[model samples]
Target chain A: MTTPGRTTAEHTAADTLEGGPRRGRVRPGGRRGVPLPLLVPALAGLAFLLLPLIALLVRAPWRDLPEQLTGGEVWQALRLSLLCATAATALSLVVGVPLAWLLARTEFPGRGLVRALVTLPLVLPPVVGGVALLLALGRNGVVGQWLDSWFGITLPFTTAGVVLAETFVAMPFLVISVEGTLRAADPRYEEAAQTLGASRFTAFRRVTLPLIAPGVAAGSVLAWARALGEFGATITFAGNFPGRTQTMPLAVYLALQNDPAAAIALSLVLLAVSIAVLAGLRDRWMTAS
Target chain B: MTRSARRTRRTLQVAGAGAAALLALSACSSSGSDSGSADSGSSASSASSSPELSGTVTVFAAASLKESFTTLGKEFEKDHPGTEVTFNFGGSDTLAASITSGAPADVFAAASAKTMKIVTDAGDASGTPATFVRNQLEIATLPGNPDKIASLKDLTKSGLKVVLCDKTVPCGAAAQTALEASGLKLTPVSYEQDVKSALTKVELKEADAAVVYRTDVQAAGDKVEGVDFPESAEAVNDYPIALLKDAPNADAAQAFITLVKSAEGQKVLAEAGFMKP
Candidate 1:
């Protein structure tokens, strides 16, 4: 017979460790030895994850990398990618945190279904998601026809469209992370503040927001990373135009078709950016609770 | 047993099972290779003497050849018993790169001479590639030609959204040749990665027009309307097919090539909007 309670406790501990830096410090004594059974597959999995990265570094056109990286087109794409990813992250934070708070703090009918719908973009193929975006927001689309006639707005084949595409695919990561953090946080602090004559909104603004700041930061970092790597949706919905809508991934893909060395160089730049972002956020989010 | 002892025992059992599985997997693979070599040796011996072909032939062809080649592949299988034909359809340049990179393909059919040159330059092809068909460019407009686009010059009209394949692709290169021949300067709303994607933009009505292959316009059926311009004759893309230098099933690959160049094969290609080379 399986012991369900014990397994659930182990799963919970594993989830917390997967949240990162705490894994290094929280269970120091538990790392004396890994059983051979787990160690073998764990090492294999590590190699599987790392071998492609090692191959990239090995076959990287190091001799031509300097000139390739310095090209005007390379910088244009990198700059666009950074700007759009940051804007998308900002947009997600403005809207997603409140949604997470609602899901965690409020009890409403069909809340479960609403939450599922919010996260639907994460699983939908980015190309399909892009098509859906077009159908709903294209020039002759359902809501888009009105926007075009009344507001003179067209979302496709522009920088703004790139941001919308990234935001569409990335916000779910922020909402899920922040919602999980909000659920884990104690809600009684808000109640105590309310009892002291603070309004519910005031209690939330002053207390709950501060309590989940770390989670929000972590979520923002994740959303930013996802937005930076967005390709299919951006290309399909926004279309690829250099200096306007071509993000690093789109540039990387196009370069791969024509110039492989250029693709590797662009990939290295993206890898460096990812490392820098994660390293920058480590101190704030990875510490033990 | 104590909980710790039980846990250790279970871990050991798992480790032992893993080792056994790995050993069995390696053993099976070695035997598989032995049988594979034996079968190939027999096939090679029969290939030199026998007129009948019986082996798997893997052909890497351009994406545009998908429908016609699939039909040809089925007909080839029916004519030759105990033979199988497999296809890997993609961009001609991509397939060329793969062949040069030592991908195990028995035959290669490229969309353009430039892409075929890559494989030939690398000395991966057995002989000079033969031109099998010629493909012309067509303006794929939304169903009913809603934008009323007629000639290539109409695409240059302000506020008319047009999409074209990226210049790296065969269709894009052909479009460029035609545009230069006509002395026209047209800016597209977007340059898609492939001909199909460019056609998709017209089908979805996102763009008023897309410059794509006549075959693609035909395949799109009621989704798009094809407009033929006289300038398309100035930039016809020739499709080339060649046998690889290191074909695993050379006999079958050769026979498959023969079938593609036959009268029946030409009928299929013509139906798919390919012109005589």
Candidate 2:
């Protein structure tokens, strides 16, 4: 009887393994009965999230959309937004990944405090962050005064300021996500590589980095999205100038004051671009996990 | 068994606290409505005589009128013991948009007739808006005018680092008009979203000068020195105030408007650098 029970268990385990590849095709909540309390609220939550997007589509001025989009100003703002967001993401990755590794793989006094401080931008209002950036980097600011006198580098009302503001707001998301992933990843592999006559840096680059590539990709995507949608800091720190510091969000806001239709058109464009990029990236990296 | 009993007691405590909160919320709302109705009824009965003003009067005014309007709001509250005067100050266009979109405001005071027209066009105003004050453009420079910016044409000087309000706002539009009238083209380093922000850029010394309203320059005090140019006379902005058609506190709103137009209100506005309309 014990032999027969063990055989049945092995057969069921094999069946689950066979079914693993097809799991993504299966519809959730279809096989088992979902409790009504959860089902109702779950559906309601979906509707609540989708209603605003649906309204935008419903109220869209389809006839004038072509003319609205063909405007040079719209394209300029869109190009600037994409360029700034991508640049900000690159900047975040260059510094944020190392910071994440430091937090996860190393030990130090006040590590807990440092970790909390790294996430400060996540809670601070973006406008306040802008003000703080101004005080730190504006032409007459504390550090900025020295920079102006010595190097003649003024950041406000410049394209570079837009990237700096976006990075300031977006880097925290990348750091937090990467740190969580680093914590969850097995450190034994890194140790094993170090044991095989490899330097610590070599172990990190050859062994640890490849293991955390997916997490880094996910964090990059999160940071990119946050940077793309940044408005308050960009407007406050960089100020708005067409073909210069004015990104799509700033254009949409200024347009809203005068022309609601044009604002809606700009919003739809931003929405479409963000959705396409997110969907494309999700299919590439998210599906692998 | 004790653990289960404790869990039940905690759940009961949460529910009891929730019920108390709901009761308190309902009581507060009920008293608010009771006072509103009582005030309205008393005013209606005394309509032939001096109607007593009570309840809250919510005024949506332009950003430029903030200093003077705030002073008048306090004086209104002081005169009427049972009344409260609240002001929502922002860009005239933004305020008009809010009022047109059915913001529960008693009065709408805009920085320009153009913005007031938006409310009037929507039939949101009960009557024709009256021009209360006028504002003219001034060049706000760093204290002592170190840049020596004397005229509108001087702003066109290269490396001057001038800031202007965006053309969408009243101050920006006025600035644009002044620039056009003078036939001088000036490219500012930044086009700020509002009058206050334009003034702030100069005050912070980020920009050498900014074209903002006289009232804003005055409000900045010693931080910025105001430079009056002849072209400002070509683009003076007329501030318009009106009572909304759907005013909840109609009596109180009327009284507030009266206070703003009164001699005392004019004195306060003049002190704030606003010209009589």
Q: Compose the digit string of candidate 1's lDDT tens values, residues A1-289.
A: 2346677556644555555234344332133435556667888899999999899999999999899898898889999999999999999999999999999999999999999999999999999988888888988789988888999998988899999999999999999999999999999999999999999999989999999988998899999999999998998888887898989999888787768888999999999888897887776576634
iRMSD in angstroms, per model: 4.1, 6.9
Question: Which lDDT values do the candidates have, in the order given?
Answer: 0.88, 0.88
Q: What digit string (tens of lDDT, one per residue) describes model 1 on residues B152-228?
A: 99999999989988887889889999999999998888878878778877777788899999999888888999999
Q: What's the DockQ for every one of the candidates?
A: 0.36, 0.32
Top-DockQ structure, candidate number: 1
**True contacts reproduced, candidate 1:** 0.45
The clash numbers for all candidates, in the given order, read: 0, 0
Q: Ten-residue segment with the worst summed lDDT in candidate 2 chain A?
A: A26-35
- The CAPRI class of candidate 2 is acceptable
